[model samples]
Target: MSERRYMISGGGTGGHIYPAIAIAEELKGRHPEAEFLFVGAKDKMEMTKVPEAGFEIEGLWISGIQRKLSLSNLMFPFKLMSSMLKARTLLKRFKPNVVVGTGGYASGPLLKMASILKIPTLIQEQNAYAGITNKWLAEEAQSICVAYEGMEQFFPKEKVVFTGNPIRKDLLEVRSKREAGLKHFQLDSNKKTVLIVGGSLGSQRINELIAGQLSWFEAENLQVLWQCGKLYYDRYAALETESVKVLKFISNMDLAYAVADVIISRAGAGAVSELSLVGKPVLFIPSPNVAEDHQTKNAKSIEDKEAAVMLREKDLDDKFEPVFKNLIQDIELQKKLSKNILTLAKPLATKAIADEVERLENAVR
Candidate 1:
C-alpha cells in the first residue's frame, strides 16, 4: 500500500515558512512512512526554501491582496483563479490524508481547496494579531492551532488549540550544549557576547543603531555576534574588529544563542518564541513597516510579562544604545529577563502539534 501523505502550505516570509517547515519536519519524524508535499506562492521565498529543506513543492500564482488600491489588486482575480485550479489539480492527483496551513498568501487557496475537496484541514496561526488569510479559512479548518490565546475573535473556540509556535528543534534542546557551542563560535568564556539579529532581509533601523555603537561595545570589553542581513553587510563589514564578528547571516543560530549574554532582535513571532526557549534577556526592536503593527503586539505581549524589552524603530536611534548598554551591564536584570522569558517557553510545541496531526488523521481514517 502507498504511504499516507500530507500537503502543507505557507510562505512569503521566513516567519510563516519556517514554522510550516518545522511542523512538516516533526510530522515526517513521527511517521517516516508519511510522504509530504508543500504548496506555496510561485515566486515566494518558499519556492526555493521548501525545496532546499528537502521537500517537493508546487507554487500557486496567488499573492497577497494589497491594502491600498494598486495594480496587484486588479490581478487578484486571475491569481486566485489560477492558484485554485493549480491547487485542486495537485490535490486530485496526490489524494493527501490531511492539509496543514501556516498562514501566508498561498495557504488560503490551498487550504480552502482542501476543505472543498472533503479533506481534513488545519491552520497554524503564528502572530499575536491574526492575519486575514487565516481568519478567512478558519470556518472550514478542522482545527486552528494557535500560538496566542483569546484568538476566539477570529477562529472558533472549539477549533482553537493553544499549542504554541513550532520552532526549530535545535533551539529547544540547546541547554546542555552551551560550553561546546561557545567554543564552536570561538567566543571568549569570560567576556559577555551579545547576539544581534535583524531577520534575513535585515532591519535598517537596527543595523544603524548597532553600527553607530560599535566603538562603545569594544570599550566595554564586550564581544558581538551580529547577523546584519545580506542588504546591510557592506556598510557594517568595516566594523569587524577583534571584538566584533559580523556576518550576513548565521546558519548556526543554536550555537549563536548558546554564546550570547544578551540578544537584540526584531519582535517577530518566530524570534520571540526562539528567544523564550533560549532563555536570554532580549531587547526587541519592532519594525514599523510590518502588517497591522503586529511586531509591536508580539513584543508587547512579552514585555507585559516583563519577559523582554521593547524598543521601537523611531526611538531606536537615541534610545537603543543606552538600553542595550544598560541591559548588558545589569547582570541581575539579565537574569530576571532570562528567567521570566524561560517561563514562557514551550519546548514541546513541535510534538504537541504533531500529536494533533496524528489524532486528526486517525479520526478521518
Candidate 2:
C-alpha cells in the first residue's frame, strides 16, 4: 500500500476523539511513512484536540440536530450539504487508502461521502449502544469495529468486529504507579480514597451531589480526588482541603486511577473502558443528558457482569450513599468488582483496531 494515506473522523467529545487518535497513532507506528488527515466538526473540540495530537484535521460546517425544535435544526440541511461537498473535495485530494469514522457529527458526512465514492471505510462504535452516525454509516462501511458485543443489532453482522475501544497507552502502567499517584495527589496512603469524574465539561448534578456529601465522606474518614471539570471548577474550587483535592481536569489519568481505591464517575464509553483497565471498584453515575441515554446503557452492561455498580442520576439522592458505602466497606465485593472489571480490559485495543484497518487497506490493494 503506497505510503498508506489515511483519513479518520471522530470528535466533539473525548470518548470519540481519543479512540480516533489511538487508532491513528497505532497505524502511524506500523507505517511510519503513512499520511493522515482528521475530519471534525467546525468550532468543536476536535478542531483543537486533533491538532494537539499531531494530526492535521479539516473541519466540516456541521453539528448534530437538536432534538427539541430550535434555530440550529433549521440549518441542518444546509450544513449537511456543505459538509458533504467539503468531504468530497477532501477525499478526492487526499486519496486515502482507508477512511475511518469513530462516530461524531462530522464523521457522518465524511464516511457517507467516502462510501458513495467507493472508498473503503471503517466505523468504530465505542459505546454498547450505537450512535446515530454509526448506524447511518453501517450499511456501506466495509468494517464496523465495536467495543461491545451484540452490536449486530445496529450494524451488519458480517462486517462487525468486536475490537474494543482504544484508551491512552499510559493507562496500562497504573498498577505500578500507586505510590507515585498517592504522592502526586498529596493524599494519605492509609485512608480510603474515592475519585470522582464527571466527563470533560463536568456534570452539574454530580458536582452538586458530591458537594452535598463532602461532610458525609469526611465523617467516613475518606479522602477525595475530584475532577469536577472545567465548567464547574470555579464553583467548586473552594471545597478543596487537605482531605478533598478538587481539580478541573486530571491530566495524568494513569496516576488518578492508581491512587483511587474506588471511583465514582459518569459512564461514558471512554470512562468505562479506562475504568475497566484500572480494575478498581467503580460506582457509575451515568449522565442523563446524553443522546439515547447511552451512558446508562454502558453502565448497565458492566453492572450486569458484576464488574461495576451503577446509580441513576435521578436515584442519586436516595441510593448514592448506601450503594457507595457498601462498595467501599465490603472487601469481598471490592475484590470481585476489580477482578471482573479487569476481565473486560482491552489494553491492546489500539493495535487490534489498527490491524483491522490495515487488513482493509491490503484487501483493496
Candidate 3:
C-alpha cells in the first residue's frame, strides 16, 4: 500500500496556525507513516513556527488584500498568479491524498488550486464570523469544519461540520494540573491567580489597560500571570512585581491556563476555544481593529450564553475596576462562568477534524 500524503495550509496568525498544527499532530498520531507538507505565506509566522513544530513547509508569495489601497494591492494580481502557478506545481509533484486549509493568505491560493485540480479539500473556519478567504473557498471545499453554530449562513449547509476549533491537547487535562501550574510559575497556590494573554504578537490596548490597573489587582489580592507578548515585552516587563509576573510569552500555555482562576484575554478565535476548554472565568477585550469586527462577535457569542464577560476596549477605563472587583468577590459567578464555558468546549476537535479528512479521502478513493 502506498503511504498517505497530506498537505495542510494555514498561517499569518496563531489563530490559524495553531489549529492547523493541532490537526496535523492528530493526523500524525493516527497515521505515523503519512508524509506531510505545510504551505504558508512567505514572511508570515507559520514559515518559522511550522518548521519549529517539526514539519516541512513551503512559503508562497501571497498576502491578504489591504482594506485601503496600498502598494501591496497593486502587486496583488501578480502575486496571486504566481502563487497559483507554484501551487499547481506543488500539487502535481506531491500528489497529496487530501489538502486541508485552516484559513489564511496561503490557504487561499493552495486550497483554491487543490479544488481546481479536483483533489479532496477541507477548510477549518475557526471564528464565529468567517473570514473572506474561507468564505471564498466554501463553495469548492469538500468539508467546512467550524467552531460555532449557525455557520450555514456563510457556507453550504451540506458541507458544514460543527467540529469546533483544534486546541492544544495538553489543555485537556487542566483540572488536575493546578498545583503543578502554580509551582511552575512560582506563585501562591492559595491566592486567586489571574492570567492575561493578548495573543502571540500582543495587543497594545490590552497592555495599556493592564498597566493602569496594577494597583487595583493588588487591592483585590489577585496574583497576576501576564503574558504581555513578545512585541511589547520591553515596555511592560518593568511592571512586574512580587504579585505580578510579566512575560514576553508563555511557552507553556497549558500551565498558564491551569493556574488561572480567572483570565483576561483578547477574543481571538484560538483564545476563545482554548479558554473554553480551560473552563475558567474569562473577561474578553476584543481587539477593535480586526476585520469584520469578528473578535467582538466571538466574544459576544460566549457572553450571550453567560459563559464569559466581554469588556470592550473603549469601556476599559470606566468598567475595568468595578467589573474586576465584582467578578473576584463573586464565587458563585466564577462557578457559573467555569461550568458554562466548559459546556462550550469541544476537546476532541483535533481528532474530529482529522477524522473528517480521512472520511473524505476514503470516499474519493
Candidate 4:
C-alpha cells in the first residue's frame, strides 16, 4: 500500500502552531508510515519551530492585512497571489490525502489553495473570537474544530466541531510531575510554588509585573518559577535570588504546571487551553496588543465562570500584587477556581481533530 501523506499549516504564535503539531502527532500515530509536512508563514515562529518539532516545513510569502493603511497592506494582494500559487505547487507535488489548518494567516492561503484543488481540508480554531484569516476561510474548510462554545457567530453552524484545544500530553498527569518538578527546580517541596508563564514569545506586561514584584515571593514564603521571557531577560538577568528562579524560557511547562499552587499567565488561546488542563488557580493578564482584543475575551470566558481571575495590563502595575497575595491566602477560592477550570479540559483534542480529518478524507476517497 502507498504511504499516507498529509500537510498541516498553522503558525505566528504557539496558539496556532501547537494545535497543528498535536494533530500531526495524532495522524502520525494512527498511520505509522504517514508523511507529514508543515506549511507556515515566512519569518513567523513556525518557520523555526516546526523543524524543532521534527518536521519538514515550507514558508509562504503571505502576510495579514493591516487594520490601518500601511505600506505592508499595499503588498498583501501581491503576497496573497504569490502564496496561492506556491501553495498550489506544494499541494500538487505532495499529493496529500488531507490538508489541515490550525488558524493562522499562513493557514488562509494554504487551506484556500487546498480547497480550490478539491483536497480534503480541516481547521482547528483555538480562540472564542476567530481571526479574520480563519473566518474568511471557513467556507473553504471541510471541518472546523473549535474550543469554546458559540463559535457559530464566526463560522457555519453545521461545520463547527467543539473539540477543545489540544494540550501537551505530558501535562495530563499533574500528580506525577509535582514531586519531580520541585526536585528539578531545587525548591522547597513543602512551600507553595507559584508559576508565571507568559506564552512562547512572552508577554511584555506580564514580564514587567513579575520582575517588579519579586519581593512578594519571599514575603509569602512562596517558591517562584518565573519565565522572564527572552526579550526582557537582559534587563532582569542580574537578579539571582534563592527563592526565585528566573528563566528565559520554560521547556518543561508540564512539570511547572504539575507543582504550581498558583499560575500567573497571559490569556493567549493556547495558554488558556493548556492551563485549563492543569486546573490550577490562575490569574490572567491579557495582552491588549492582540487583534480583536481576543486575549481579553479569552480571559473573560474563564473569569465569568469563576474558573480564573483577570487583570487588564493597565491595572497590573497598581493591583497585581495585592490581588495575587489575597488569592494565595484564600484556599476556598483556589479550590473553586481549580475545580471549575478542570471541567474545561479536553485532553483528547488531538484525537478528536484527527478523527475529523479522517472522516473528511474518507468522504472524498
Candidate 5:
C-alpha cells in the first residue's frame, strides 16, 4: 500500500554497474512509484553512468586494494572506514526497505552496513568467479543471485539462485536489427563483419592484436567494426580504412551486435551474458591481469559448454591466427556456436533478480 524504497550499489567497471542498473530498471518498471538510490565508488564511471540512466547515485570514498605495495593499499583501511560510516549514514537517512549489491568497492561497505542494521539485502554475482566484495557480504545477504552455476562454492548453497546476468533491454532485439545495423555502420552485406569489443575502457592487448591483424583481415576480405574504447581510440583511429570502422565507444550496441558475423571480445561476465543473448559466434580473449584470473574463468565457463571459444591472453600470440582461421573458415562451426550460446541466454534475468528483491521486500513487510 505504501511506496517502496530500494538502494542499489555496484561500480568500478561497466560490467558491475550495468547489471545493477538493469535490476533497478526492472524494479522501477514493476513499481512505478518506487524510489531508487545507487551508491558507487567516488570518481568511478557509475557516478556518470547511473545518472545518465535516470537514477540518482551517491559516491563512497572506497577503492579496491592493489595487489602490489602502494600508497593506495596503505590507505585502504582509512577508505574502508570512511565508506562504512558514510554507508551507515546513507542507510539511516534513506531507510530503504531492501538493499541490493552487484559487486564493487562501494557495495562492500554499503551492503555490509545494511546487513548490520538488519535490513534485507540481496547480492548479485555476475562472474563465475565471485568478487571479494560480494563474497564478504554474502554471509549477511538474504539472497544471492548469480549468473553462473557452482556459485555455492562462494556463497551459501541455500541462498544461491541462478538468474544469469542482467543485460541492456535494447540488446534483446539485436536479432531483428541486422539490416538496420548494416545500414547504420555502412557495411557491405556481402562481406563478413567482425565486431571487436574490449570492454568500456578498451583493452590495450586486444587493440594491439587487432592492429597487427589488420592486413590479414584485409587479405581475407573481412570487414571490421571495432569499439577501441575511449582510452585507445586515438592510437587506432589512423588505422581505420574502407573495410574497417573505428569507434571510441559504441552507444548502439544492438546494431553493433546485429552487424557482427563473428565477434572478438573480452570475457567479463556482463559481456558474456549479452553475447549469449545476441547469439553471435564469439571468440573470447580473457584478460590475465584481472583479480584471481577470473576473466579466464568466465570465458572458460562458456567454452566448457561449447557455447563459445576462448583464447587466453598468453596464448593469443601463438594460437590466435590458427584458431581464428579455423573459426572463420568453418560456416557450420559459426552456426553451431550461435545456436549453443543462445541456449545459455537468460532474457528474463532482470525480472528474475527483481523477483527475489520483491520477495525480500515482502518479507520485510
Candidate 6:
C-alpha cells in the first residue's frame, strides 16, 4: 500500500484548533507512516499553533463573514473564490486519503472542494449549536463528529457521530495531582479553591465580574486561582494577594484542575469537555457575542443535563452572587454536579474520532 496522507483543517479559535490537533495526533499514533497537513486561515492563530504542534500547515485567505456590514464582508466573495481555487490546488497536489475538518471558517472552502473532487471528508462540530461552516459542509461530509446530542436537526442523522470533543492528554490525570498542585500553587490545603478561567484570551465581562467579587470570595474563606488572560493581567494584577493568585496564563493546567474545588469558565465546547473530565462543579458564563449565541447553547446543554450551571452574561449582575452562594454552600449539589458532568466525558474521544477517520479511509480503499 502507498503511504497514507491526511489533510486536516480547523482554526480561528483554540476550541477548533486543539480538537484538530488532537485528532491528528491520535491518527499519527495509529499510522506512524501517515503524512499530515493542516490548513487554516492565513492570519489566524492556527497558522502558528498548527506548526507548533509539529505538523506542516498551509494557510488560505479565508475568514468568516461578519454579522454586521463591514469591509471584510464585501470582500467575502473574492476570498471564497480564491480559497476554493487554492483548496483545489492543495487537494490535487496532496491527494489525501481522508480530509478532516474541525469547525472553523477556513475549513469550509477546503472541505467543499474536497467533496467536489470526490474525496471522503469528515467534519467535527464542537458546539451544541452547529457552526455555520460545519452546517454548510454537512451534506458533503461522510461523517459528522459531534460533541452534543440532537445535532441531527442540523445534519443528516445517519452521518452524525456522538464523539465528544478532544481534550489534551495531560488533563486526563488531573485527578491524581491534588497534592502536587497544592504545593505548586502554594495554597493552604484546608481552604477550598475556586478556579476562574475565561478562556485563552479571557473575557472582559468575566474579568469584571470576578474583580467585583474578590472581597466576597475572601469573606467566604475561599482561595482564588485566577487565570485573568494575558490581555487583562495588568489590570487585575494589583488585586492579587496570598489567597488570590492571579496569573496571565497557566502552563500547568493539570495542576490547576487538581487544585480546583469549584470552576468558573466560558462554555466553549472544548472547555466544557475538559471540565467534565476534571469532574469539578462548574459555573459557565457563556459569551453572548459569539455566532448564533452558541456559547450560551453549549452551556445550556450541560446545565440541562444537571451536569453544570449556566449563567448568561446578561444575568450575571443579578444572578451571579445568589447562584454562586447556593452552589458553594451546598456540598451535595457540588458532588452531584461533579458526578453528573463526568458522565458526559468521552476520555477516548480522540481515538473514537480517529476510528471514524480510519473507517472512511478503509471504505475508500
Q: For each candidate, how many residue pairs have backbone atoms clashing (under 3 Å)? A: 0, 0, 0, 0, 0, 0
lDDT of 6 at 364: 83
Q: How many backbone clashes does candidate 2 have?
A: 0
Candidate 5 residue 303 Cα shift, in angstroms, is 1.3
Candidate 1 lDDT tens digits, 222-316: 89899998779898998887668888878788888988888899988888888899998999988878888999999999999999988888787
- Model 3: per-residue Cα lDDT over 318-357, one tens digit each: 9988997888889999999999999999999999999999
Q: Could you give the C-alpha RMSD of every candidate to the true structure, in order shown?
A: 1.7, 1.4, 1.3, 1.6, 1.3, 1.8
Task: Select the stronger candidate by lDDT from 2 and 4.
Answer: 2
Q: Report the lDDT tens digits of candidate 5 across residue range 85-152.
A: 99999999888999999988999999999999999999999998898888888888999999887889
Using TM-score, rank the candidates from best to worst: 5, 3, 2, 4, 1, 6
- Per-prediction TM-score to the true structure, in the order listed: 0.95, 0.97, 0.97, 0.96, 0.97, 0.95
What would the C-alpha RMSD of candidate 6 be, to one decimal place? 1.8
Model 1, position 63: C-alpha lDDT score: 85
lDDT score for residue 240 of model 4: 54
Q: Tell how far residue 15 is off in model 3, in angstroms.
A: 0.9
Whole-model lDDT per candidate? 0.87, 0.92, 0.92, 0.87, 0.93, 0.92
Model 2 agreement with the true structure over 272-328: per-residue lDDT tens digits: 999998899999999999888999999999999999999998899998888999998
Per-residue lDDT for 59 in model 3?
A: 93
Model 6, range 1-365, lDDT digits (tens) per residue? Answer: 33799999988878889899999999888889999989999988889888988999999999888888999999999999999999999999999999999988789999999999999999999888898888889988999999888999999999999999988888988988999999999999999999999987788999999999999999999999999988899999999999999998886889999999999999998899899889999999998989889889889888999999999888999999999999999999999999999999999999899999999999988
Candidate 1 segments whose C-alpha is farther than 4 A from its true place: 67-69
Candidates 4 and 5 compared by lDDT, better number: 5
Assess the local accuracy of residue 160 in candidate 1 as a C-alpha lDDT between 0 and 100.
93
lDDT of 6: 0.92
Q: Who is ahead in TM-score, 1 or 5? A: 5
Displacement of the residue 82 alpha carbon in candidate 3, Å: 1.8
- TM-score, structure 5 vs. true: 0.97
